[model samples]
Target chain A: MTTSKSNFSKPLILVTNDDGIDAKGINELIKMIDSLGEILVVAPDSPRSGQSSAISSGYPLRLIPVEKKEDFTSFKTNGTPVDCIKLALNFLCDRRPDLLVSGINHGSNAGVSVVYSGTMGAAIEGAIVGIPSAGFSLCSHNPDANFSACSDIVTFTCRKLLEQGLPQSVCLNINIPASDKINGVKVCRQAHGYWTEEYDRRTDPYGKDYFWLTGQFINLEPDNEETDEWALAHNYISVVPTTYDQSAIKYIDTTRNLFSE
Target chain B: MTTSKSNFSKPLILVTNDDGIDAKGINELIKMIDSLGEILVVAPDSPRSGQSSAISSGYPLRLIPVEKKEDFTSFKTNGTPVDCIKLALNFLCDRRPDLLVSGINHGSNAGVSVVYSGTMGAAIEGAIVGIPSAGFSLCSHNPDANFSACSDIVTFTCRKLLEQGLPQSVCLNINIPASDKINGVKVCRQAHGYWTEEYDRRTDPYGKDYFWLTGQFINLEPDNEETDEWALAHNYISVVPTTYDQSAIKYIDTTRNLFSE
Candidate 1:
């Protein structure tokens, strides 16, 4: 363990991920952003993919320190990605974090996938707390997926976020193509899409039936070039400004009319 | 068990909740909307609060048949609320459901709580699949909370949804006050708010420390009467048209500029 006085001038950065602290993706993210500022890594001890904004409750959460250095310290928790952000904000960090970055996730969190992504969940949680935040993901699911192509984009996005803060209640969802030669970057919206789920039903040795979840994403508008899905398909990094506010303002009046009738 | 031929004339309704199969809130919700259509319930076997759009993967999910009747049938699964919706859409329901309703949750899913609510997760999942959907919640966390006051609102809202479908990719988040006489209903937006978390730290007998999550919600705009928090505080049932598309459209251009520079 190494201890030193806090540097007051440098920014404090809180880093977290849904793929757990030991995952290659998160480690890659830390290495990419090491020069950004003072870093605090509080992440889940186990993989928590598909855990979107899920907070652990009805039980106590535990945190174990993994590493400590002069400007970088790390801890692992038996909590979800959102819980890690909450714990860091409320208990761990001595001062408010200047920036919060989550993931160089092993899988893409684009389009409708953000709703089921623990990587985006951490970033959303950070934005909800008024922190400039961003989540980065590669369009690959392999545990040993190479994140080398994402380093430049991740660093660029974080630098921009830190330089020019996002609007209130907004965060960035950045998805990179799994290619060494990235085409370019495109600012896009979440593509309107849904998963066409296929459950693999199987009978156990004891004759009990069970099902495993697997799905193919159905892009409602595949031809729309302004969506994250389209960007990723074209080998471009997609950067979608995301928010936690789910209110559909356009339908408020129509919904009121329906109730009135 | 009772089996009858499907009635094509009557709408097929799918009901689910974050609270487990036996929860009073869900049962009350089922009873309230029974007259609207034939119902199929696919819900978690155990409570899955705070699971927002979380899909269970890398493991097999088991479903147990609980009850069966001519017009009503239910199966409980070892999955999250969102998983229940996916299972219902992909595996359980024989035909496409005309409507999907979740909750009458034991607690409120208003303000910023929707991001953490398994009830809303089910509803959002239903909407993503193009089903007309809604989630109901009472502002009470009591397991045995009285839901008699929520009956009329629940029935009225469901009937309206069945009569006039919502816009694409939209769903309703209807939160009711726990009172015998409700003032009225208000169609409102989600209030901008954040929870001020307070972790109750304790040391176990094994000399390890743990934290229990507890928090108070702080409304960012307390005087805004157009928000759900204000409507709920005024004893009115708050109806927010919610969507799963979290893209911040207003910031897309600004973000593009940031990346370009």
Candidate 2:
């Protein structure tokens, strides 16, 4: 683990989220980074989960000012995770951050959820911009999720990154379980899992129809100890060094031959 | 290539999309697959790009009928890409299809766009459900972009999948460049590239300020011919096997070593 460069220059930290400003999780996260460096937040005005890296192609984004404290100015934006990052860099922040941390998301972004996590989308956008970043999420979905256990780990991880510069083209996804105690941090791989979907139909007050989508999660590799799931389940903070490129390098050879003329 | 399955029930081809039923893309796609088999479309009522493999962790999904064309049934749903696949398999479709096809997406889902594409999400969901699937996209953003060139290859690809079943946990991401004279199909890897995001600031008619995000696509590996970008540049349909496991398997050794006490 290489440490982030530490000169006299204060590290510029860009903070954003999928959950809106009122989210207690982000509040707790903000407290942890108070003394680290300068902070600027431009998060979504409302929760935009399962939005992935979606950018508003039709509707324009609206950035509104939110409460700010010393060295911590915040704004709420009507956009997706990707939109928030774009706004932060191109409009809000003068320069890129030493780190861009998203979430402290309301729930787990482990396994397949990571692919669809707005929190992660922001982090990946930061990595795309050549900035070392991470997305942190608690396993609890409660709006007032007790983030007591995650604060120390979050601070430790950020401090570590501030010490050891992260590897290029990679962002970290740190998901902590909903527990009173954390075993420690474990660098692990994304667990293999997916959701089984179901649709419930209903009628509106005006006789118009509406639908709500819901589902249950299924993990294929439940017993894998080297996975993020194992770490999270065992009350440890799981740090998965995630990459944006989803290439199947190992099978490239076998696949190339399959398409050969 | 091998031929379609010789004697079982006519090859069942499941059709779905990220675009709603009214979307010209899905309509064009369904028309293309009209004669392929029993075509059942379970798509969103609106465009859902960048949805990835995210699911509706909310209320039950509502599957609504959109339009009924002769031998083609169209249904609208309030769900994500993964939702459409799960519902089509567990609730809607009578049985798993020999082939599941998603998109002739209105825009390019090439390069790094696959990570955020709801189109590919649907296809990946199909693979997870033990069904062979393929996602097709046209490198055009025009509302009425011509898909006349897509016929021969799509039919041939469908036949190929029906014959030589795709490898497990694999689905094809076929990105067709916007050109009439294509150099045939090229099997390639995803190009390492990203959008250099730029946000456009705007003020609404109301006295309030806001921001709109925009960007230009930049290819990092401009000279790499083994990538999807090169295939697109050469005016060929790039068929890259896109995966979602997103496990940094190669880096596991290094990362695990970092975690060692």
The digit string of per-residue lDDT tens for model 1 on A37-120 reads 888899999999999999988689998888645347898999999999998888778788889999989999999999999999
What TM-score does each of the candidates earn? 0.97, 0.90
Worst 10 residues of 1 chain A by lDDT: A1-10
Query: What lDDT score goes with residue B253 in model 1?
Result: 91
lDDT of 1 by residue, B1-261 (tens): 122127778888999999899899989898898888888898899899999999888588987888655358888999999888887777667678889999979989999999999999999998898999999999999999999989988888888888888899999999999987789999999999899955888899998889998888999998999999999999999999999999999999989899887
TM-score of chain B of each: 0.96, 0.92
- Where model 1 places Cα greater than 4 Å from the true spot, the runs are A1-5, A68-71, B1-5, B68-71
> Positional deviation of A52 in candidate 1, in angstroms?
0.4
Q: For every model in order, what is the number of clashing pairs?
A: 1, 17
Worst 10-residue lDDT window for candidate 2 chain B reads: B1-10
Model 2 C-alpha lDDT per residue in residues A1-261, reported as the tens digit of each score: 011123337887878888877788788898999789877777888778877776676577777777556457787888887787777777666555778889899999988778778899888877776787889999988997789888877887777776665666678888998998778888889887766654455687877655566566687888898889888888888989888776666666655665663
Model 2 DockQ (Cα-based): 0.49
Per-residue alpha-carbon lDDT of candidate 2 for residues B80-167, written as tens digits (9 for 90 to 100):
7777776667655665678999988888888888877888988887776667788998999787999877877677777778878777
